[model samples]
Target: MRTLRMILLAGMAASALTAPSAGAAEVTALDLGAATAARLAMGHVRFANGHDYNATVGFGSGAFHRPGDPPGTLYAVTDRGPNIDCAEIGAVVGMSAEALCAGDTAAKVFPFPAFTPTIYTLSIGDAGVEIVDALPIKTRSGRPITGLPNPLTLTDTEGAFDADGRPLTPDASGLDVEAVARAADGSFWVAEEYGPSIVHIADDGRVLVRYVPQGLEKDLAAADYTVKGTLPAILAKRKLNRGIESLGLSADGRTLYAALQSPLVNPDTAAYKTSRAVRLLKIDAATGEALNEYVYPEDEAASFTADAKAGKVKQSDVKISELVVVGQDKLVVLERISKTTKFHLVELGAGASDLLGSPWDDPKTSPSLEATPDLAAKGVIPLSKTLMLTAEGGPFPEKIESIALLDESTLVVISDNDFAITGDQTKVVRIALDKPWN
Candidate 1:
């Protein structure tokens, strides 16, 4: 089978998350669909010119590296486009999105309702990786922008198709963008698991405003560009496609940090399976309001279980993909669970605990900021974390969902190869920051 999957990706590219005890951390990776090729897409089922959209260019879902780049250049992003595996057309086990392909309604919720949503740019260093540019995401008179969804009961009212199964028309400027943050005048602000919105593009990729969350603002006002509901309202209780992955900005960009990739079906879903409180935002990036809020606990999907009694962990697995800002109010978060991935270091100081309009965003508080029990004995408190890096080896790659810190001793890391059709491989890895750069 392709030489046992290239010997299990060369033993997970020698992982153990690249030991760093004093070994001065170092890890490399590279592999990004051999740096693109053409024959893009059209009606692919698996291949034919309609496939190889270069493994759908999953673009690490969100990354950045500017500030006098040219070093190892970085800038990835891509999500909500080119989806697959609604059980490959049968879609039954634990339905999601278009209710897992709703009886194959021609694979709704996008098989590629015209993909678009891109941003690549890579380049990396130490002699490998390439791609140098890709851009797509538009609409400021430019158009494009797909990744279909939004335009119904508000958010993931999912539904779109057309590979002959017909019915295709979602995309109220669809955006499931997931984490990205860049703005020292270059603009860019991503963060959108559909309607968890937070957009703000400009600097060339168009889109100028989208905020979403308070009552879905007339379901994104007939969007095609520019929408703004302005968040909070208990984040409208998220959890459709798990809202707002992770987006950050402060360091004078005037605050803005999101992060809530799970644990909200709020008052139910059995309090979202024993809630590990998740809801972190500190906005005001020029008025989306919500100035502070905390409580961001997760990881305890039996604490990152890669495998337990062969039952392969569950509890909705866990997420909260990436958050960067590194210190001025701090944050470095990451945290994943499909096998393993970690990185902590939070610190929102001023003694944490804001939880916004508190009472733990009621859904009948009781024990529900994800089962509170004693958040510093109810004075709340949560924003404290430390760990930093934890993917301890064994051929990992189901999704490391992009992260970048590129200098101050490099850290890059990327993944979300669902485009690799689950052979899941979009390696970028780079690790090497043990210390002395903080």
Candidate 2:
């Protein structure tokens, strides 16, 4: 029996490696233990031509030079299929290739057709996670939309609509949208790097409200209020501080955790060094007001940066990507660099509280933070069970972009394919979270 099982397992891995391109990969029979969820719900931004680009690049292929010699393609595994319908949105018309390619010619000549947003539902079956349906989402104005690399398109245009077919404007300037999170109520919040930093959108893609970090009203007030001139100009003047990139709400749906995508630069410094501190700000879910800011310890920041600079490690940036609430006051953060993805369990200390004054807010009462030096001192506690998913299956290259928990014990991971048309592959994979991280 052991011999037979070994053969079957070897064959499965082999088949997976050489599987012909067809529809998306599917799983029909998964033997997950009781600790894991039976049905995993997953969401991602997939391209029609089976290519995915980094949210940063917007439209073009992500190609760069390694430290040594020739430049190579930055292979992303997150772009999978169920192509976008660009015509549904205005993306197909009057669309400039500026966002798609790094070079002018590359942007003008990229071959993929324009597309609009379509939700593809995947079911875990005997085969694996497979696409069950592709449903088109309509805006309040009755037009279809797709995601683009530009923040204005991703946040301001893709998911929004006015009553009379005009775009619902955001309140603050330079609100370049980077990522999005859906709420339990079906409403969505977009994380923008530029200010009017965050925008709240209704299900029909209407801009219901906007959230700006405190202390920026004067700068915004000085600008003419037109999204084009005001938002980007202010963002540029402020040295392009891309505020928030990742966002997650509390399990109870009252508190929000927003992660800054990059370090803030000190204008006084001659050369840009990684900010000594990276912050995870807590906010009131109801009002989108700032509750508290948690800064990473200096030692931890130094260690992360050293690893990246040494070339011994790849993901040196240590940007926080996504946050998940695990227990009452405990949260899990997905921190990624160019080459590493780490899952951290953070306990915001007691006295660290939320807007509603829930017990979970009092860091003094919570063990994760109260016993520690300060709420910010606890730094990110490394969970023993870590999964080192590679860019490729083993030696192959893949770039993981986004992750979502289908339940407590199952994780859905998506890779970005960097929109390469040849010599690249996109993947969406699932793994058990119950496995030992240590």
Candidate 3:
């Protein structure tokens, strides 16, 4: 049966290549060697309203429009259990497409237990983010496992449920979630925009640890010299503290770098001004302590903000979507505007003494120094190289929300189909970055 399932899956994948399409410009065929050399892997989730189905693919040419795909074609693995009334969207990783398509018992893979029901970004390789086999997660109660959805089933697939099988929705108070670093051990650390700021989950969907930003608040206040908002409130705000948007970790996993999806307000400002600068934070992973926090230079911030105010930018929000530590001192940042994507190569240097400066003292005006001294004291860094608009003019204009490195030269990008009434197309795109990032 397993052998038969594998054969059928291969055939289905082959057929997928020729799936009917509305005529659009043909994209360059993916170079598998370049993709493999870059060590990229791609995956995405799908969102469907009754009339149309959209599947978001990771690292593909943004969203592809397929007006005729079946409603239950895409699948997502959730933390809810089987007894709970939920839709079976698709098979989890390692399940055969044939078995999933058949909706048979043999198609059953794993079950997600105690994992938070939310959207997640996955990593492709071992360095920062990588895939993991079915593994038990450490829990306060006991050991818990992950599960996959049966793609063939088409019941209620939209929302996640609680232990009582009640549907769990993002509350009226929006919840913030950001994909942090993929650990060397193949697990992922997610920073929340709300309280209990950190959550570590294994790839198979098991909760490991939840870190609350309690102890770090005092230090963060001391470093930035402002404390109008709590850690949780900063994370929960939809426009600003868009929870854990970017994650960067040291090679050894001791230090962490985080960026918010939107600009953090200067606590002193009455009508807070938004800056193009991305916040760089150094965290102690073991203790969940924010040792230092710094902002990118005002010059860089002005470059992007000026364009945004002039309506010359594709996206209004200068969100840092993804972060990867290249070496000890180098970091790769993926910046997303509505239709444009930019890659920035940042260089880490010594810490600064006054990272906040006048921003903490007088929010109404700009600071004297282009850069903050506290950031230097806290070991904040600068961008050494940058790549802008690397992948544009593809199938659908992308709102890239997640990214993973397949290898040194390949990257998998995922688009979030925001579950709109108009039926947005979700896409996963694979790009081969063969050239130097300068």
lDDT of 2 at 185: 78
RMSD of each: 20.5, 13.9, 15.2
Name the lDDT of candidate 2. Answer: 0.38
> What TM-score would you give candidate 1 relative to the actual structure?
0.32
Top model number, lDDT: 1
Comparing 1 with 3 on TM-score, the higher-scoring candidate is 3
Across 184-282, the per-residue lDDT of candidate 3 in tens digits comes to: 665656665443245566665455555543333332232111122222222222232343566666767677666655544443222123444445566
Give the lDDT of residue 257 in candidate 2. Answer: 67
lDDT to native, each model: 0.68, 0.38, 0.39
Q: Evaluate model 3: give its TM-score.
A: 0.52
Worst 10 residues of 1 by lDDT: 1-10
TM-score to native of every candidate shown: 0.32, 0.52, 0.52
Please provide, for model 2 over 290-403, each residue's C-alpha lDDT reduced to its tens digit, 9 standing for 90 to 100: 666554322233244324555654222456555555555465555555444455656665443232233323423434221233434544331222222222232222344455
What digit string (tens of lDDT, one per residue) describes model 1 on residues 7-59? Answer: 23233554344322222245656544433533222334432223332344567
Query: Lowest summed lDDT over 10 consecutive residues: which window, candidate 3?
Result: 1-10
Alpha carbon deviation, residue 405, candidate 2 (Å): 1.9
